[model samples]
Target chain A: MIATRIIPRLDIKGPNLVKGIHLEGLRVLGKPEDFARYYYENGADELMFMDVVASLYERNSLQDIISRTAKELFIPLTVGGGIRNLDNIKSVLRAGADKVSINTAAIKNPDFIKKAASKFGSSTIVLAIEAIKQPDGKYFAYIDNGREYTGLEVVEWAKRGEELGAGEIVITSVDREGTGIGFDTELIKSVADAVSVPVIAHGGAGKLSDFEEVLKNDVSAVAISSILHYKAITQFQSQKDKLEEGNLEFLKSGKKYSKIEALTIQEIKTAIASKGILTRN
Target chain B: MTVNLKQVVIVDYELGNLFSVKHACNKVGLETILSFDKREIENASAIILPGVGAFGDAMDNLNKLDLAEPIKDFIATGKPFLGVCLGMQLLFEESEEFGAKKGLGIVPGVIKKFPKEFRNKKMRVPQIAWNQIEKPENVDWGTTALKGIKDKEFMYFIHSFYAQPIDRSDILTITNYNDFEYCSAIHNKNVSAMQFHPEKSGEIGLKIYDNFKNLIV
Candidate 1:
């Protein structure tokens, strides 16, 4: 059996790592490189750098950051957001990203998935679906960080992504994201069951049990941002002077987010392992 | 620490992560050159065939650049050659990916894909996760680059196809995914290859590179 991966998702806005509630009210955390290095040292299975505002900006600004991190860090680095055409994927991969996650582009032109997979190989292409739960209990795919609706059902889109040769699928729940409650396991389970590709559960990870809860739904990995970010802020002191982009108020204040528990990657993995779940030590 | 003058020649076929491999080598204090030049590859003290794309495209690039013979010649010199991921798969006779594509045939084997459904249980292809590498029974890792590495150590893997060496003696490590066991690494004299990306496996991965750097005579 493949060991379940514990990935720390770092949502990037401009140059700084940021966190928000329900993917809104964005707050700058610190330089992404600092957080990335910390997570690597602490045994994160993989690190995801998602440009949360890339779609709106119409370009990805992660090349410099990805290249810098890939120089010393030796692990799978996945970059998502604003990846549209083959050139965009190629450039990011050349910039040292192991995989490129596509959302808005894939949703607009479904064939983009096929083109990317064929060009860069399926293993290098990840289908990132941002899903927002509807009032009718169904999940709909959203774009631009849950600002635009694609009108495509989450489960069906996942199946199509698999058919188009996506090696993995990351299902992010907009409703439960950043709430510190838990993962939207129902949405995760629906998508996981609809496709054979490895599914990465993102959004709504607040505590150790939240990770455990999501892993039980046949998901291959869990991408935790808030829980890991909160833990990191308390442990490591960022170079505040170097960061000039994004909101630095919360980070400079040194006040912790009271809602979520800060837990290290190792601690979470240990907790999962105790539950008989296989994780890389 | 004395600076080792030896350099590893990482083949640049435009299909693999050459930068990370070179960076890892440099981190371990080994100089490296990312090149597809035939003469440069043949003359290097050590060679690393790092790849991460489809088998057909990799082979095509190798042929296009006329690197197929030089790589074989380098291995023939017994100067330490390491094949990573698709690079390891390219050493086989042929691969079943996108049809039967010919490989470098350095090692006698065929690259086969992981079954989509094994024993009625759906298996996730492209096994993109950290899986443990175990020394096969009667295989002592002390002789190979995996020396000093613990048994069942996890390594990052991202591939849908795996190698099946015709000679059992070449098999270095075995990894089981979804109850399917397959060869994860191979050792044939001076030629060594692994299915996992040692450069991307964290500190343990650096240890592997360190071992490889030491292997250079």
Candidate 2:
């Protein structure tokens, strides 16, 4: 089932979860724990923390955030960035966070994914990718926060991560992040089409309609910060419900909502054709 | 009023997250103690094994603390004992996922490596991420613990090579992929094992632990 996940992507720049695009360009926001707790209660499928530190902070402020988050929130948390070694992954996971996501580290050491998965579990590891749309229409996975191109194809790496035992693949469009231009549909479809593990689409969600569009492309989740960051989207809890009502297939949260099945690709297309779906503003 | 006896002892293997496991038991209105002491485990009514980490390291800690034999004897008494993921795998004879290490051998199986088969399958081993699951059959769904939950309900799962139960009757539920029909949950009288982390599986996961909490035979 396509589980509609509301994930708050927090950009951590020492102690505080800052937000920005590519590299060290981050603006200070509220404390990570406070933001995490808000999302936890309001309805978040899961949470992901992107460590903006170049993997070299004296004190692991991001870790401090994770430790704090672990105390207040009971939901699963995926901490990424600067996770170059097994020890980096272990520290946060041991602090009570559920999963540890690695991007550049996994690329530098393909063995990282395999080791972490075998040591921990595949579910506890996520391989983060940012694919840039080339002039040739092929998406190349970028690393080091989009500063350098890994020169590897998105589909190939996805297959590799799965082989390496990466439980899930979070594919973000580096070209689209914070641009709010809209998510890279063809790129997501390509990666999602390549691997069976769940795929999360990040970058360029300017409106709620964008979420619908991405889910329509068959991504397991639509991750947003800007739209929800402002009063533009009055509520986040209803995001999941809206997807359910629109006939998109999703995984159930179990306790809180009615056990309605999410719409799969065939179901979604059929619903659209049969006038059972609409573009709600 | 929870003036009742504490029916379960959530064994803290010291890898991580002991209280979360204990808290799940508490939500079910069952009394549970976080015990690292050998004395308390032997005296407790039931046992819970909760852990998260490397197989070899976890086994090392369990061995160093010298709590291994006591745990085995406690389970031998036929009281309800539940193991989550690494905790469950540790109940086996040996694990090949890492170099080569031994488990408690409480269950007559060796933790082998994830088959080269997954190398060609859609499922990535170290099966991280949440996925669909078939409803557990051995446990009664009528209990309030599984109140809103139904068959084929989805729960979070994270692991690589799943335990292949020697006794077919011991298999409780399963999830499938291209060529994988993983043994999701297992049970043998008073002993229950889950490949998924019930403590981290969100509410449905928490509910399973709650069911385990109320399971006072």
Candidate 3:
């Protein structure tokens, strides 16, 4: 049995790590490097750093953080957000990202996937699709963190992405995102069924069962943020003790943390294993 | 015997993630040099070809940098030569990635795409996940870099195509994905390559690199 990947997604806004519900209400968690190292130490199969505001900002601050993390972390690192052109892709890969996920940019220039995949390799390119369901129950691809819409449906878009040389497809549900309700398994299954490349199910994972439900489908990996991050805090009981000494002050005294019980990567793997799903232990 | 302190050199042909491989080697206390210079490769105790890109483009870069023949020459020296991912593919004779491209030809094999039958069914093309690898029938896992790693241990893989070695005996391990079992690792004399990325496979992965470090030492 193949080991399903349990990935920790760190959505970055400038230098700080931020999280939001439905891709809004941006809250800074801490430094990207700190969060990245924590996840790596805790058995995160892979790490995804999405620059949530790279399009709005003038400068991309993720390169330095990725470089620093790659120096220490051996697992594959994927950097997404604001990757628009060949030069952008080149610089990110050169900066030490094993793969680059293109969402808005690929939608804007569909041929960019082909060009990037050809120049670099299909394995190095991942298509990040943000899907939102419409009134008719049809899912359309959204861009810019689900703020905008492309008329194209997600399943069709994922197939096209694979045809265009994307090695993997990352399907993130905008409607279910940040809600911690659960994963949109239907959406995941639909896209995973449509594409031959590996599909990573992202957004709206709230519990252990959430992971199991999605993994039972064709999802190759799960891109989780809220559950993993919150779990890390609650499991440790306090941020002061859980976090490294240098970054202790990142969590302010008056700030409220998620009361939801957290689970570690090992715990999640064990839960998945109990369900008869094999994962890297 | 003058022991070489710097035991590994990750060849940089301007293609894949070279940093992580070097980082993995360093993590295991194996000194490495990320070099494109032919002389550096010739002088190193071992050479690691790590890449992720189109087969045609990678070959083009290696040819452009004139490191292609140097790589073959180094392999002939019988010092351990490890090929990772695309690097593993490049060790073969040719690839069907982009209209039939030639590889370094160190190993008698051809790089091929996963059939659409599996693609149309349960398995994905790239098979991008952590998958278990088992030793070839009647072969000890010790013969390859997978030494000390338990059987069926998971390693990270991210590729659509797999290698078909001309000699079945050259295959060190096989991984089952979908309805097919494909060669996951190849070992021939002092040359070895794996389709999986040990650098991205975590602690067990680092242990594999550590084993390779010891093999060369």
TM-score of each: 0.97, 0.73, 0.92
**Considering DockQ, which of the candidate structures 1 and 2 is the better prediction for this target?**
1
lDDT of 1 by residue, B1-217 (tens): 9754778999998887888898889888889988999999989999999998899999999999999999999999999999999999999999998899999998999999999988898888879989999889899999788999999999999999999999999999999998899999999999989999999999898898899989998
Winner by TM-score between candidate 3 and candidate 2: 3
In candidate 3, which residue pairs get closer than 3 Å at backbone N, Cα or C atoms, i.e. clash?
A: A231-A262
Against the true structure, whose DockQ is highest?
Answer: 1
Which CAPRI quality tier does the interface of model 3 achieve? Answer: medium
Residue A31 lDDT in candidate 2: 51
lDDT of 2 at B40: 88
Q: What 10-residue stretch in candidate 3 chain B is worst by lDDT?
A: B116-125
Mark the regions of model 3 whose C-alpha exceeds 4 Å error after superposition.
Answer: A234-261, B1-4
Model 2 C-alpha lDDT per residue in residues B1-217, reported as the tens digit of each score? 6465557888876675575676566666667777779988887788988877677888898889888988988888887788877788888778886577888887776665555445454443445445555654555545433445666665655565667667667666676643466676666667888776666656667778667766666
Q: Per-residue CA lDDT of candidate 3, range B1-217, in tens?
A: 8655656899988888788898899888888888999899887889999988678888999999999989999888888888999899999999997689998888898999988775456567777888888876788877678888888888889888899999998998899887588999999999879999999888889988888888885
Worst 10 residues of 2 chain A by lDDT: A254-263
Instruction: Score each candidate by Cα lDDT.
Output: 0.90, 0.67, 0.85
> Candidate 1 clashing pairs?
none
The candidate that wins on TM-score is 1
Looking at every candidate separately, what fraction of the true A–B Cα contacts under 8 Å does it contain? 0.78, 0.21, 0.78
